[model samples]
Every structure is written in C-alpha cells, then in structure tokens.
Target: MDVPEEHSYERVKYIPQNFFETICNDNPDDFETELKKVIFSHVDASEKLGQKSLEELIDYKSQVLLKDITLFQNEGGILNKDIIDLEKKRTATYRKSIEEGLSNKKLELANHQSNKPKDVAKLESNGDYQKSIDEEIKYKRAEKEKLEEELNLATKKKSEQKIKQSNLERISQAIDTFQSQYEKLKTDNEPFLKTIGFKFEDAVQVHIDKNAINTLVETVKIKIETLSDSIKPDNENGLAFKIIKLGEEITNLQSKLDEPTKRYQTYLDDISKWEQREQELIGAEDIELTLKYYEGVLIYLDNELENDLAYKREQRKGVVSQLHEKKRAILEVYKELYKPVTGFLEQYKNINKDYEITFDVSFRLKDFEEKFLNYVNQGVKGTFYGNKEGTVTLKQIILETDFNTLEGVIEFFDKIIICLERDRRPGQGNESREIQSQIKNGFYLDMYNLIFNLDYLVPYYELKLGGKSILQLSPGEKGALLLIFYLILDQDDIPLIIDQPEENLDNQSVYNILVPFIKHAKSNRQIIIVTHNPNIAVVCDAEQIIHVSISKTQDNEMSINSGAIENPSINSSIVQILEGTMPAFEKRELKYTLTKNNMHSIPV
Candidate 1:
C-alpha cells in the first residue's frame, strides 16, 4: 500500500488497498497479466515513434549552412577563399603566442620556489614553536573560565532582584486590597451605627488601629493562636476567662436580637395570610355584584316581558338572516374539501354517486336546558355560597319548562327568584343571617341562569356526511375522513411526519390513495413516513433508503449494522429479506407486465 507521508495511521491497520493487494497476491499470475495489459494499452508505439521523429525533424530543420558572399567587386577581385585563408593564419599565430606565455609562467614559478625566505625553513625546524602555541591555548582557556564565572554571578544577582521586585508588588496589592475592604466595611456599617446612637469611627477604633495595621494584624494572629492553644489540654490560664466572658456576652446579644427577628417573621406571615384572605373577599364581592346585576336584569325583564316579546321576534329575524350568510361560507369550505374526501374513499371502493355534506341549524331545548343548569351550578360554586354547605341547589333555580319565546324564558327565571326568596334559609348567628340576606337578594344564580338561557338561544348546527352523521362512522373511517380533511385544509408548506399511517389502511387504499397523495404533496411540502412495507418505499421512489439489521451473538450481545441502500451489504440484505429472494422480484415483474398489457388493451 502506498500511504501518503502527510497521513499518520497509528491505529488504522488495514486500508482498501490492502484488500486489493491480498487479492492480487492470491492470484499473482492473473493479476500480473491484467496489470501488464493495462499498462501496455496506455503506451502507443506509433505515438512514441512519432515523438522521436518530430524531435529529429526539428533538429534537422534548425541546422544552417555557412555561405560566403562577396561584399565588394573589383578588377582581379579579392576572392572569398583568400579571405578565409588569411583568417586561419591569424588564428594559428594567436595560439603560438599563448603557448609562449605559458612557458614564461612555468619558469617564473620554478625561480620563485628556489628563492624562498630562510624564516620559512627555520620555523619548520624550530622545536619551541609548538610549546609556545600550547601555552597560549591554555591561557585562553583560563580567561574563558573567568568570564563564565562572572556571567553566573551576574545572572544570580538578576534573579534575586526579580524575586525582590515580585515580593514588593504583591505587598502593594495586599495593602490596596486591605484599604478597599476597610472603606467598604466602614460605608456599610455607618448607617446602622448611626441608627443605634454609636459613632462608626469609635466602633472601628475599638478593634482596629489605622496607623499600625501590621501591628493590629500581628496582635489578632497572636490572639487567635493563644485562644486555640488555651482551648487545648495545655495552657489553661492563657486568656480562657476573657474568651468565656466574650462568649457569654455574644449569647446574650443574640438572645436579645432573636425576639425582634421572630416578631418580624410573624408579622410577615400574618401579612401574607391577610393578603390571601383579602383576595378571596374581593372575589366574593365581585361574585355578589355579578349576581346583583343578574337579579336587576331579571326584574327588568319581568316588568317588560310582554312588551319585549315583540321586539325579540324582530331580533330573531335579523339573527336568522346573519346565520344564513355564515352557513353559505361553511358550505363553500365543505364543498371544496368534499371532493378530496370522496376521492380518498373511492380508492378503496368505487361509488356511483358523490359523497353529500349538509349543514342544518335547529334549537335543541333539552340539550340547552341541561347546559343552562350546568352553567348555573358552576357560577354558584364559584361564589361565596359554595363555601357554605347546603346553601342552595341549582335545580331549584333551573326549572324545566316549555318556553317557546323570549318572554317565556324571562318569566321562568322570575318565578325562580320569587321561590328562592320565599324559601330563604333560616339562621340564628350574624354570619348565617348575612347568608340568608344574600339569598333573599338573589345571588349569582339569577345572573348565571339569564346568561345560560341567552347563550342557549343561539341555534346549533349538525353536519352530515354521505347522508349520515359524523358520529355514525367507525374509528377507521373517521380517522380517514379527518386525515383527508386536514391535508386539504393545510395550506402552509411545513414538514409533516406520520408514524405507520398505513396501520388502519388496506394495501389497495395505501397504494391508490395515500401513495398518490404523498407523491403530489411532496412537491409542495416535506413528508416523512415510517413504514415496514416495501410498497410505500419503492412505489414512492424514495430518495434515500436506510436498512437497519440487529443481530444477537451466542453471548446475547446485540450488534447493529445500518447503511444506505447503495451499500453492497445493505443492498444484498434488502434483496434477501425484503424482496424475498430474486424469484419474487421476477414474479412481480411478470405480473406487472400482464397488468400493463391488460390496461392498454382496454378502450379509452
């Protein structure tokens, strides 16, 4: 394997090249033949020969012949050959002159060597010269050692100076910190000291000395050490009595402070409780006011009951007109979404007629009265009446009656108020008497009943699907209808994730309705579906497919292998496990071909 020098492979023992190399080694003869064929195919003999020929042609074309031309012509003209002969003779003359100069140089070198100075000979023969040289070298060595000693001494002084400078800087920082702490403590305690009729400066002076801070620190340290030692088995008389007296004083002071702290905490607790009680009373008062307002409305209605009936009839006509307009808008939405619902349903089973959706408005007196009673009961429980046991029952106020007009509804509530006053609870204490008075005045029940009846007067709507009510459908059919409705109603391009959407759907329904819908919807928004069925994955032509395999060994250790569809091992596993071998795929292909032909043979 040819590994790049830039890569550091300490743990990676094998690469893809190693596998290929092993395969090649196992079949060396076949590998060698294939490698040689591949190498030789890239090498063209004709191209190689053409390259050589082109090089030779360029060299031949670059050569130039020397030609002599006459510059001037005269009678008995000087020929070109004569000029060439003269130039050759001149060249020979120059070469001979250079040779003569070389000979002179050789002689000069010999004469100089023979006439050398006597000092040069004497120095070569002198025996004391080597001794002198060794002495000088020894002296220089001593001088170097002296210089090194001086350098070491200078470095030691520099290091000592640096240490002294660092200690001075640290001492300066400690002094600054101490000064800042003193100022902050003084500022924080000044106000408290003033409130207690004590001077802050005098209190600080008793424990601290500003002029001699170091002495103060030393004194405090010595006191702490002495105190610690006296508390031990030895040194029984070392400031033990002073420590005991100070401790007794501290305990007395703490005892004195605890009384006020407890009082303050008690005050806070009582305040919180009172605040909560205040909120409850406020809620009760609001409920009473609401009930009073309802009572007044009922009285007014009772006084003008016959006269308002004619006015209510006109209002009902106008409300009906508005209700019709809202009904048309709802019908438009139903009409728009109904096609998708029917299209989805028809994918499983074809229907000759379209699915029908109709909306109707009508008054349900029984349901209205039940809801009115519930509202009244809720309002009563939300008031102070609920706090008392057996105060009143909602049924007493909500009577069952056939009221066809607005005047009849008001008269019914008026009768309820009169009965409540007549049957007011008899009490002895002031609190019970107050409750009886409130009941006599008509509590929140009157207002609650009036609001409930007014709300019930609004017409209710019923939606029918395929000539049947929505409540009549089974769970699966209802789910299908709702899913289709949401898909049609959703206009934003947000991703929708569904897990096992095909659980309640038949394969035919999944393939025809769900698959086609997802395919079309994917263009506008992202759809992610988790399914175990291959039909959904393959029919949808999913961009990416992941196959996860979990297997346990003999030791019950599970190992998982997950990869994309493009992986060779994953492709093999999918084909074997999901497609059920190659034969199944072949059978499917044959079936599809027959189906396609049958469809083509049918008339348009």
Candidate 2:
C-alpha cells in the first residue's frame, strides 16, 4: 500500500515465491477468476500466444515484442490478487488524471479560439499586446523559471548517466574476469571427462525447463545405459556384441551336435542287435552277410560322422575362445576407464574445500564400496528388475555382500543384471535379444559425468541452518529459526503477525530465548502475539494489553477490552486473567517479590 514506485505486479515479485501459491490456495472460491488474473499478470501463458504477459507493458530490447515469455525473476515469483487489485487502483488513478488533462486541454483550446480575433486586434492597436508592463514581465519571469527547471532536470539526468556508465564499466570488467576463470576451470578438467565418453555437453540445460538439468541428466544417463538393449542383435558393434553373436553360434552348434550323436548311437544299437540274433536265424548265412554289410556301413558312417562332430566341436571351441578374448578386452577397457576415475577420486579427496551454491552443500568423494553399496542399498530400478513390490531386487544381496573393489562390485552387478535379463527374456523373438544389455553396475548413474568420475556425493541436499539440519532441529527450534529469519534476516519490513510464539516453548525458554529476542525485535517492527505469560506481557512492559472474550451463546460475539498497564482497569484485568484471580494474584505477590536481578521468595 505504501510503495507505488513500481507496478504492483512487479512489486509483488519481491514477496517470497511460496507465499503466492499459499495465498492462492487459501483464496475464496469466488475469487478463483481473480487469482488466475493475478497469476497471468506476471506471465500470461496461453496455447496460442505462449506466455507474453508483459509484452504490452514492457518493450523487448527496445524494439521487438516478445511473443513467448516466462518469469525468470525471484524463481518465478509473481503478482497475487492483492497486487493486481492495487495495480488496478493505480491504473484507475492514472486514467482519471488523463481524463482531467484532456478536459483542461479542450477548455483551453476553446478559450484560445474564442479570444484569437480580440488578441489580434489588441496586438495591432498601437502595440498594446493585451497586458500591462508589469504583467508581461511577470509572464516572462514565469517562462524563465520553467526553462530553468528543465535545464536542472537535464543536468541531473546527465550526472546520473555518468554514474551508470562507470558502474557498467566495473561490472563488465568483473564479468570478463569471471568468464576467463570459468574457461580455465573447464580447460583444466577436460582430460578427466574424456575417458568414459567422447562427447562433452553442458552439465546444466536451460533454466526455463522446470525439468531441465537434473531431469535431462537422468534421462540421458538412462538412455545411454540402456542403449545396448535398444540395439538389435543384427546391429553391428564391438566386443560386447561380438561376444553375444558367438554365444548364440555356440548354442546352435551344441544343438546340432546332439542330433549327430543321437543318430550314431542308434546305428550302433541296431548293428549290435542284428549280430546277437544272427546265430539263431533260419537263414544264418544270409543274416551273417547282412550283419557284415551293416557293420561295414556303420564303420563308414562312424568315420564320416565322428570327423564331422570333431570338426563342429573344434569350431565351437574356437568361437568360445574368441568370446572369452572379447570379454577380456572389455575388462581391459573397463580398467583403463576406471584409472582416470580412481585418479580423479584420489585427487578430489586430497583437496579439501567447500563449494557453496545458493545453499550450504557439502560434497565428499565416496570410495568404490561406499558408492556401490549406497546405490545398491537404495536399489536399482533396472530394465528387468525394478524397485517395486514383488520385483527382483539387488538390495538383499547388496546388504549381505562386503564389496572390496569397484571392478568386483560391478562384476557382481553385471551377473545379477545378466541373470535377470536371461530369465525375463522370452525365447525365439526380438524380446530375447535385450539380454545383451550394455548397462552394468553404476554406469546408469551418469557414469561419464565428472561428478560420477570423481564419485562425489552429498547423499542428499542437506541444507543446514546454524550448522544443524532441519531433521536434527526440534519443532520449537525450527519455528524459532524461522521467526528469527523473518524478523532479522528477511528485512522486508512486511508485517509479521506470529499467532502463538510461545506455543511449544516452556516458561523458562520463553523468558530466556524469546523474550529478549522479541524485546529487541520490537524496536524494528511491532511484535504482536497471542501470549498469556506474565513474564512476557508484564515484564516486557506491553504498550497495549487487549482482553478478548468470546460469547458463543450470543451468536459468537467477541468483546475486546484494550488499554496499557498504566491504566488501573487494564492492570487489574491483566492480574485477574494471567494470575487466575485477584486473590490468587495477591497471594503470589505476598509469597514472591519482583527484583531487578532475581525474584525473591518470602518465608511463608
């Protein structure tokens, strides 16, 4: 209400961002329309026009009108209904002033048109220009005064412009220095980032995308990790893909070997049965000849088929060896990749420093075991095994196992993922091919990102106030801190009406902590609170004491009695209410006497 230097919509952005949402949620049902208008005043978003709310109000780059816009100030802070209403009031005042000016202009124009001929006649008649000498001089002096005011305004503007230019120069120099240092940091870190991936993109994306930096990072990480599953077996790739194809080839050979082996065994059995029955046959000679012929055919078959089986087995063995070689090569690649990370971790650990963002964030590089265990314990929501009810999980095994190295931990995770893929994949179709997945262990956790390489972690964003996290602080302590922040640190001079400051505080706590704070805070802003403690009200010497009584029987009528402690009636009311009655108050007064240093107890 007091500050009208800026537009109400713009000024409202100064308020805490959450306060807007809270107030909107609390708004009456009928004011829903007004709430929407208030929200849109900051960024009028629509399907057709996008969000160019202030396009009409603000000229973009002094030329182009922005068609799409989003609020970037104060993390998307905007006007509320109250601010919009205030803006409306200001607009109405401006419109009234403009209308008045137009009316005055019309009247002045009419007077000028009517008096023009007379003015001309006066000017022609012996140089009598419709004014006395004194009046004409007064008129010239008034004109000179207006011109002087304009000149003074121009001089003031010139001085202000020079100051602005000087400030801009300093700012520009600081910006250049910042960019130089940032480029150097990136250059120093370039080598470490290249081991896991060939490409390097920004760690953060556009701020306007609400789900930008972290979300995009996670999405890209998942896609990169799961990229192997997406690739068809027909797709040509390196060692991993070759290993899968060789595995399938060996499996086919194993199946083909079973056919030849089974057929050769059947042929032997028939020849043996024929030999056994030949001696007892009526046509012994013919049977013996048949057996001999069959035996000879079996000999030929054994020679050809045995050679074929041996050749097939040898070929499968060669494929298996190749598969093993590919696997070993991959392991070697993994070791090479891990060296940079391990080195990065060691370097990061050796250095000790705190990097501050908008909040207090502490980061430390987690070792192989610590990082692996944390992720596994938290659970992996893999393609085959998800972190859901009844889902096959790594958590159980993770809790049981004590990991020694990153390689060993990853090997175990790879086995688990491989087993899950094999179990879940169906036979004889494209679905089975996903078993050749590339994501192994913690690679999905932005494996190539420097943060991953360093294995730096904060666990969660532990925002601390006074070196204590919110989780560590009790409700009273949290409230107290918030109150202190609002009163002392926030410094906005916004009205703070604390409903029961001593709600959770004990009497001693109120006196020791809150009483002194409120006393000091009162000098800055009025501290209004609903408190019943005599130590707070009486000791602090309240400027006003209000005795409120609610009568529910009489249509919930509220009666308020207000006065200072100096007033007899107010003092009596305070004693009666706070001390439970005048008799009890007098009894307490007789027992205890107030003093500067300490209250003394009288002997009973």
Candidate 3:
C-alpha cells in the first residue's frame, strides 16, 4: 500500500473524467434535478449502473416510453421543438433532396416536397407543392429572355467594334502616309535644313508646322551662310528658293495629314469604349466558360430548347421518391429519439432503496401549441409588415384548437410557421445544414428527449421525492436527503472524511438515518466523521477517540488526548469539553432502564 508503483495518476483541474467529486455542498442542492451528473458521476463508480446502456435506454424512451407517455399525457401530440424540427428537416432537406447543377431550383423543390404539409382540412387539398416546378419554369423563362436580349446586344456591339476598327485602320493608314512623306522630305534634304539654321536637336522636333519651318528658312543666318558666305536674298531660283521649295512640299503634306490625325485619335477612344462594353457582356475573365454557362442556363430556361433537363428533373423526382420510401420504411420500426432517462431511472432505483424518488416523462400537446404560438408572437414583434391576415388566421386557429393526432398537430404548426416567416435573408434556414451534420451521433438521440431537447423541448419531466415532488420538498428535507445519499451509497474502503455531518440534520433524524448506515458502512471501510455530538461518539461504540486542543499558554502549541471510554484522563477531558452533553444522556438513561433487552439493533 505504501509503494508508489502500485498506482498511477495525473493531476487534473475541474471535475476529473471519472466524476470522483469532493462532496462539499452541505445542503442537498437540486441533486434530483442534476440526476444525470449524480448517476453518471463516477464518485460511487458502480459497475451495474456504469454497465447500463445509455443508448439503449434513450431508444426505449422515445420509442417504447413515448407510446405510453403520449397516450397517457394528453392523448397524442408533438413533444418538443427538436422532434418536430428533426422530422421536418429529415423530410424536407435530406429525404426529399432535389438538386440540379448551378441553381437553387432543386433546393426549392426539396423544401416544397419535404417541409410542407400535404393535406390538412383547411389546406384546399391541392396536389403536393405543384408550384415548385412550374413557378421555377416561369421565372427561368423570364431570366432567360433577359439574358438573351443582353447577349444579342453584346453580339451587335462586337460587330460594331469590328466595323469601327476597320474604319479606324483606314484613317490610320492615311495619317501614316502623311507622316512617311513628311519624314522623307526632311531626311532627303537634311543638309539643306541644317544650312537653313533650323535647330534640329538630336532628332527632328516630334511635331513641326510648315509655317515654323518657313520662318526658320527665312532667317538672316540662312541668307548669309547658304554657299561660301555669299549673302543674298530675294531670288526665286537660288538656295533660298530651294529651301522655300522644301517648306512648300511640307506644307502640302500637312494639308493632307490634318483630316485623319484627329479622326484617328477619335477612333481609338471609341474602340476602347466598345471593347469595354463587350467585355462586360461576355466576361473580362472566363469569357469562354461564361458563354458556355449562359448557353446551358438558356437551354434549361427554354421550353423549346429540347434538352435532357426534363429527364434530369424527372430523375431527381425519382430519387426523392426513393429516399422518401426509404425514410418511410425506416420509420415503421424506428422512433426518432428516446431519452435514456427511463433506463437511467431503472438503475437509480436499484442503487438506493432508501431514495424515495420517482420520475415521469410526458408529452403534452397543449404545451406544444402554446409554445409554438409564443414563438409566433415573438417572431412578429418587430416585423414592420407581414402576412397579418394570414398570421391572424393562424393564431386564431392555433388558439382555438386542441390537435388530436400527430399528423394534425404537425400540419397545424407547419401552417403557423409559414405565416410567421419574414422576407427571409439569405442563409436563413441553415439550421437544417447543422442538424444534418449531427445525425446518428449521441447528439442526434438527445434531440428526441420527451422531457427536454437541448433548449428546444418542453418535454415534461415529473420528479417526486418521498411521494411529493422534489420541488415540493423543504430545504431541510433536501439537505437531509443529500446527506443520507452521500453517507449511504457513497460508502467505500478509502477514508470517508466528513466534517460535522450532523450539523445540517436535526439531532433525532441524524441518529436514526446516519448511525445505522455508518455502522454498516464501517464494517466494509473506514468512516472518519468530525463531530461534537456525544450520542454519536458514545453510541457508535468507538474503539478509539482523539480530542484535539490548542495549548492555552502557548498560542503555537497544540495537544491531543487519545483513549476510549475506559481511559480516565480522556473521559475527564470529554466531560469538561462536552459540558452540557451529559444532561441529555442522563435524561435518556433515566427515561429508559439501561438493559441489553431494551436496546434494539438497527438493520444495516
């Protein structure tokens, strides 16, 4: 026992995995309500209770227990939001999933197929959600026409851009020819230009006017420096005349160049605009894919396109039907969820016979109706405008009705829900996605709990303590009950350290319940109780007793006196320390003669 090798452990914060708790609460504080923690907590670590299948029990409640409780509760009705929501999502989302490529047509069809109630007496008894397909067709056709018109405009723009580009190229050619002639004229007589005193920097000036060139050629420098300093002016056939001839030719080319130059720039700007608009219609990126995608969507939209979309839609319907059939087949033998509380209760009953506790889970239809309407009211509170007339009708119907059958209840709630809906934002119904991901896990089973469903249920749970409800029990009784359970069922070989267990219980109640239990418990394991009560210390037949005391003279010093009832000094100290305690034992002795025949042994 002293060797470290015999055991292993790791330190942990908060409650450990085994649920071995330090029972510190002096009073019974909602232990009945916290039955899950109580039973499953590995404090007692019972093999029988631990071995009980929580899964099996949960199944039993919703399946087997549901039948009895439903019929017993208020005839038959929906239990909580979870079971109803689960049924709707399963029926609406997964089972009747109708999907097509690149559209919400399938999802709409699926929603219509699954979530909607097919037949209620008030529902005009129309064919099951016929609007899903025909409405889709109408909407698609409208969209298809709009896109087609856009595509036609884009095609026309493409043609216009091509035509404009060609016209621009011709204008550009005229401008280019003028440029070539002008460049040739300059280069053909480069020496003449330099001699004419034109400041042709590294290259000719980018844009030159014939007038400017003419002004340069008439400079005094040009007249003086023409040929070997022969300064002259005013000759029609001389160097000045030759340079003037060059200017005249440039002026003629400039006249030809003027018309196309502005027009060429205008064409460039216009083509850029045209191409931008073209890119918008087709796409800047993914132009090929975009066109192909448009073609596919148009085909789906076109009634006369003569494609396999109908076949595909039909195939989807067939799949939905098959899934529906499978769901129905599964439902015949399976219940959605059964809380394992019933199974838990069965084990709890055996764990402690002294525990006079009983629990009942019931399904109430009236509660469901009230809850659903409350939900409706809350949903309508802030909405600016809605289907008020529809809501009024639904509320009235909900207010006036007691739905008898499960089908009737579901249909009624479905209608109410439809009326309560707002102009939903995108992703409004994504709860179905979340629920779908959780199926068949332990969480899925918890959804079907009759009494509760993870904030979703009003499944009724009735817990009774001592033939009266745990709720009806007084604080004292609750405290006493908590104390007894801790003392009785929690008995084990490890030292049971209790500080004044008698403090909460009345003295008589303590003697009756605790003493017998502690005596029986002590046979199996050690019981360490800190108490000031003399009746407990003497009557429990203690083999040894230790009295702890602080030394009066020395504050830091402490002393302990140890012995049984036979030890003199310990007896003297016990009398002095427990001064008033002797009178109660004296009265008890005087009231009844102390004989072996007078005493009766309590049953363990």
Error of 3 at 270 (Å): 36
lDDT of each: 0.43, 0.42, 0.43
lDDT (C-alpha) at residue 307 in model 1: 52
Comparing 2 and 3 by lDDT, which wins? Answer: 3
Error of 2 at 421 (Å): 18
- Please report the candidate that would top TM-score against the real structure: 3
Tens digit per residue, CA lDDT, model 2, 1-604: 6666553443211223233233323532322233223323323133213434322222322121111111111111222222222222223344455455445544544554454321111122122332243234335434544544454454445455455555655665656666665566566656667776543345522223224344544554454334433333454653234445544543343334334343443444344445434432222222332333334434434455445534543443333333333333333432332233234333333121221111222232345433443333223333333334213333444444333334433454445444433443234232321221323554333322211122232122222344575446565654454444344333334455665666556777566556555665677766666665656787667798887878999999998889888888888877877788899988888666544225344444
Backbone clashes under 3 angstroms, per model: 0, 0, 6
Candidate 1 TM-score to native: 0.27
User: Judged by lDDT against the true structure, how good is candidate 1?
Assistant: 0.43
The worst-scoring run of ten residues by lDDT in candidate 3 lies at 11-20
Candidate 2 has a TM-score of 0.31
What does candidate 3's lDDT look like per residue over 171-256, in tens digits? 55656667886677567668766888774445555563355434443442333344312212355544334444544543343334
Models, CA RMSD each? 52.0, 43.5, 31.0
Flag the better candidate by lDDT, 1 or 2: 1
Question: For each candidate, what TM-score against the reference?
Answer: 0.27, 0.31, 0.32
